[model samples]
Target chain A: MRLAKVQKESYDEKEVLLHLKEIEENIDFKVIHKIYYPYFHFEFNVLTKGLMKKKITSGCVIDGVNGRGALIDCEPGFNQTPIEADQTIMEELTYGNAGEEAKQFMYRSASIKLKSMSVPVLALKKKTFFYRPFYVVDDGDKRSNHLLTIDSITGNFHPI
Target chain B: MKLDGVIFLVYLLVLLGIGLWFSRNASKSSEHYLLGNRSIGPAVTAMTMQSSSMSGYMFMGGPALAFQQGWYALWYALGDAGGAIINLSVLGKRMRRMSEALSALSPIEYLEKRYESPAVRVIGSVISIIFILAYVFAQFIASGKALTALTGWPYEAALLVGVGVIITYTVAGGYLAVVYTDFIQGIIMVLGVTGIAIMAFSHISLGEVNAQLASIDPTYLSIWGKDLAYYGQWGVVIGAILIYSVGYMGLPHIVVRHMSMKSTKTVKGAIMWAATWNQLFIFIPYLLGLAGIVLLPNLADPEMIIPELAYQFFPGIFAAILLSAIMAAIMSTSDSLLMQAGTILSRDIYQRFIDKRATERRMVWISRICVFAGGVIGCIVAIYQPPSVFTLVIFSFGVLGNSFLVPYVASVYSTKANNMGAIFAMIGGATTNILWTTLELENPTGLHPFLAGLIISFIGMWIGNYFGRTPSPQIQEAVQNAKTRKKLSNPLEKKISQDMASESKVISDFVRKKMYINEGDV
Candidate 1:
């Protein structure tokens, strides 16, 4: 089966290669393929009882393949073609109420002003869905295949 | 009836409430219980770090040393004032990123992953448990003393009350409760110390105080401590400073703060807040000690100097605040130590060894059990064989710092540091410190045991590296990733800074324009 084709490489390939080397030496890179990942960007307007307002922009990146949360360095790129992904997981990532994560972040900021403020008021200001580019590294023989994801933006790879 | 007694009771209730409030979050997952899901903000992070590090040592032991040795105490305080700053500067950002990258939940786990050896984890966990307990045991004793000073209660009764509160917060709510309570405690500590110092200065003139100290003993004002003729005075001074300054890196309870922060971006802000707190709070204790020389010279225990000064100088409510501050210091440290002990046992020992597939619920229960056991043991030790709080604190601090400093530093900053080197560093450092202290070798050696331990530990690490085994491919990769990760700065960091600046400006505008009214008054 043919994997998805990688269109744009905004991140430095040499830098990513260096980082991959750090995670493991002598990476016999059999096949390095770029897969576009998906995420939802969230901008929040946090209002507190101290009559103070804080505007925060944070992104929630979900691994398209695994359908789990990921920590990426930069926001997802605007232009990319989506490969085969779990539609249900993508819907949950984008359409799910920002209640859980927002509440956690709100509590953190709220406690700072908690002495003066009773409750934190968080309003979703903006949400955008975009795809991030990741280099999929396949190494070793067919029986002992290793997989690694290198962020195309910052060359940051989630430790396997 | 002393109104202060009522106020102190109120403080305890508030702490219990906070603990109960966080119990739900703590029970949700092992991560929440152990590290608050690493979602803590900069202010809370800074407060927890400072509050845990400062401890009863800063409140009672630090001033006591100053009372006995005069200006010489400031040598230790000087290092302490910069301890958090130095810790954050060296280990903050890198550790945060690396620990997250490695998915290490605790300090021992981090070392294990970094060095690629379960032996490192076992040895590290054992050392952490022993020293942390010793340290917490000292805090337990200090809690009793602080209570005795506040309420005129018997030592046993005070100990039970203090230990009960600490155990409740620690076991019931875990790390979230510890950090939240620590923030409140940190505020009280600073306010109480600053208030006491200001009142003491107002009550007595500096010139008169100095003159009194000079009359008592001219050496009290000497930079070399009470007796300038003492052997190895300078060595002792260097030891005192070095122990606190670099020792913080090795402290699992303190270093866990770096691991538990929301992100590496939060560190710069946390450092600013922590350094501000250190500057404001550190000198007050020594100053109070100096004032005690003139004010309460006939007191039996010098550690009670701060409490006596509070009662003598401040009003009833203010005295209660000061007493709570002392409790705050004791509780903040004991809880963190208790928490670390629990994490080491449940996560490092039980989960890793006993039950490899332990569920989150099971792990949380085990951690709470460990916390309770630690408290019981600490209480018994404090009750049965209480040592001088200052001496015990210094001893524990020295041992842990000396053992872990070389290994911890090597893991983060040095590429050549290996599992063998770390092993030797821990053994050499701890052994030297223990033998020197137990055998009373410091006097003859013309150096503090801590200094000797530190030196020997570094040498051990260096020599061991020569014969050290080559790193496994995975370990090499982890090291490389961590090192190169720092070189690639995340754009998210800059964006967060920009967001914070705009938020701060908005808050400032509201304050400056008097646009916000106190909802309380309304």
Candidate 2:
């Protein structure tokens, strides 16, 4: 399973907008989230994902839009959505083999089968724009934790 | 008739007032004197960081270099820009967090804690005294040269006036005064360099100068020198400029800026401001230098290009302002270096090793006395150092870079490093730098002594690391555990250890995958 920082507002109901810039850079994830955000998370087969056929380990990460990372996990259905962001706006992000051949390290990870999640925000008639940033923490036993902020109303993830 | 005298008085008064303003706190605590309470604001921090790092070379001597060379000097700005960008993205976060955690009283003190090597600290403290004095002397020479050129004052008289200004401000205000004055000086520098560039460019078109230059010498534009009169080529430009730019990491004066910043949030913003302003302002000298090529072809002394251009194009008031700006650049650099060396000698070396039990009040007084003494020593050296101001400044930077920064920068990030590495690095760098300059090995290659010294130091540090004593494993483990909560931890952390540690395994996997998707393969 993979995750993006979720906006605090709309923590429960909204589809989070995870930056999928890297995925777009290589194999496009444009068709994955064309439909409305999946409720209760469902499985979707990735076709022609460049290296999609290769099975990934529990903590392996792949680049998506806006320099966001999409990690492979053992969790249930995770709805991976895409957003539009370029290199200039967001900082550089990397996973397995970025330039360096020897060093292998990451910010945080776990062995669970985790899918990706993003909360989308659409404020047509509301005055307040809900935004939240999520942080992933590691348990002492090598497990993972995600603490995302919840939105006040309409409950959707927002990006700055 | 007393225009120079009056202006000198005004400068002295401003510096004095600022120095005294911060002296109150300095007298109360060495913390304020050495580290400025680690609460410096972004604006003051930006100005102080850039101005101190620049030294007087950017003002008078740089233009003088430009006058002799052409567009090639612009590489200095590019190198600085490159360095600033790296600082923001790479070193900035790490420095801000690491310095805060260590709470170092001096640059070397910070190094000791970071590498857990007291030997590095001792070696660094000694180097600080030696090269800083040399660098400070260079500033004094630049200041004296500017004063003499502008007012035709006696060299000794000029040196005295410059010293007086440095002592007054630094003795009174301490870091706050230095920061405030640097902001003022930074503005003056920008105004001065911009005005000079504009006035100089207005005198001739690039097409005209290029044409004139071509008629004079076929290879004038080439990086390599065809005649005796030539600017440095790409290697010199890249090598020299690269040294100027990335070299900030190794510089004691520049590193202190990060330690003095307001907060972590301010680090990025301050960096952006300092980098942009520093790059643009310092770069203007390139145009002035190129213009000097066309305007004054056979001029033996290249340093006079800016002043000559000011006199040639603008009216009297404009000339006065340009002169003020030039002085602003020179004085601004000298004052900061004077204060830095004074504090390092007094608080870091004298107070640390000499009198460990000295009261904060007494230390502040000692620092003040050192400022005065340092200024005096610099004046004496500048008045008599080997002829030219530019050479003096280059020598000073060479000594500091090869010896001080080489060891200092490397020790900051590495845990396996030791005191042996620090000593060898300085020795190796200085030895190679001297050999290069003396043997003229860098002659055809055009690599500067400072850069050569740094490269040598890099090798020296490795040699030292291999032979030096390593820390115990238990101490190393404790340092690592403590470092886990650092705000500036490497992005590739194995475990999340901060307050955010309660996140779920499910969430961590999701976020990591999402994060990796954007990051690409790293």
Worst 10-residue lDDT window, candidate 1 chain B = B254-263
Q: How does each model score on lDDT?
A: 0.65, 0.49
Cα error, residue B440 of model 2, in Å, equals: 4.0
For lDDT, the strongest prediction is 1
| Model 1, position B485: C-alpha lDDT score | 51
Which segments of model 1 are wrong by more than 4 Å?
Answer: A1-160, B1-3, B14-49, B90-105, B174-181, B229-231, B253-274, B412-414, B473-522
How much is B109 displaced in model 2, in angstroms?
Answer: 1.7
Q: Write the per-residue lDDT of candidate 1 for residues A3-55, one digit (tens) a residue.
A: 33232454555656665555456555432554444444454544433222223
Candidate 2 to native Cα RMSD, angstroms: 17.6
lDDT of 1 by residue, B1-522 (tens): 356667887886787577546644444432243244245666656654555566688778888988988888888888877765777666766675566555564577788888778888898888888888888888888899988876778999989988997787554433223456666676676777777888888889778889999999989898777876343556677888888887755566323211101223234656567668756667778888988998998999998988888878778777787687668657766766676676677668887888987754575567677777778888888899887788888998899888888887778776778889999999999999999999988777778888999899999899888877766776666566656652322332322222122112222233333323445446
The C-alpha local distance difference test score for the whole of candidate 2 amounts to 0.49
